[model samples]
Target: MTDENTADSNTSTGTNTAEEENQSELTAVRYADGSLGYPAHTLGSDGNPPVDTIDLREYTAEIITWTKATATPPGVREPNTLAIVEFEIDDESVRAIGQVTTTEITIGDRVEPVYVSELRDPTAGIREPDSQAWDGYRFKPIE
Candidate 1:
């Protein structure tokens, strides 16, 4: 693997190969100050940072810790309690909450990233349970 730090710089026009441009977009935000943001999926509802989407790998995780929700946040009534999970992504760890009914998630369980639709139940009265559905990343244990 070519070390990106030591990779040859285009001393001429200052551009790399065409294949590099076609590769998956890295999950980083370059600041005007020449600093790089964290490489992570912008899948939070907090509206803090990383307002753009980032590339994420699927079916490549193992659960490290999990917490089963005991109570709904405030307004929701009949919504199911999701399991908040922290899992490994390469050497880095990522956290995402996932829906579960019959199966229980445990540490070290092989998990994978899954895109779930936003919970759209009018009866429950919770319009946005977590955040925008497509922006959220959920995980499921590999069967």
Candidate 2:
């Protein structure tokens, strides 16, 4: 699975085959100390090494908060809905923030990560379209 948490080789360019195939995967870091963190870290928060890598997409999360951004950065959609959700994985809590699939959501709602080919229009940004990747996962509320 391609790690979608950080700017790795698979995500550095928009033309990468993995990205082109929409193979992005949301990953998290698991520390030896039993702590979990989003945006996978090279080292643990305690300064130790990571014990495992987990796919956040495999789990469901609870929306802790949400908001809509009317004034967004270039390439992002206007009135974009975003949320902070927490996942309970192996008795550990991992929180992540990302775009929401819809604005019709509330705190405490259950959500799952769904891969999207583009989070925003790469051509709309100041940078060259091929300079970076555009694919990522969005939070979708579960029924």
| Whole-model Cα lDDT of every candidate shown, in order | 0.42, 0.80
* Candidate 1 local distance difference test against the native: 0.42
User: How well is each residue in 28-95 modelled by candidate 2, as lDDT tens digits?
Assistant: 98998999988887888689988889988789999999998999988887778889999999889999
Q: Which residue pairs clash within candidate 2?
A: none
How many backbone collisions does model 1 have?
0
Residue 25, model 1: lDDT of 35
Location of the lowest summed lDDT over 10 successive residues in candidate 1: 1-10
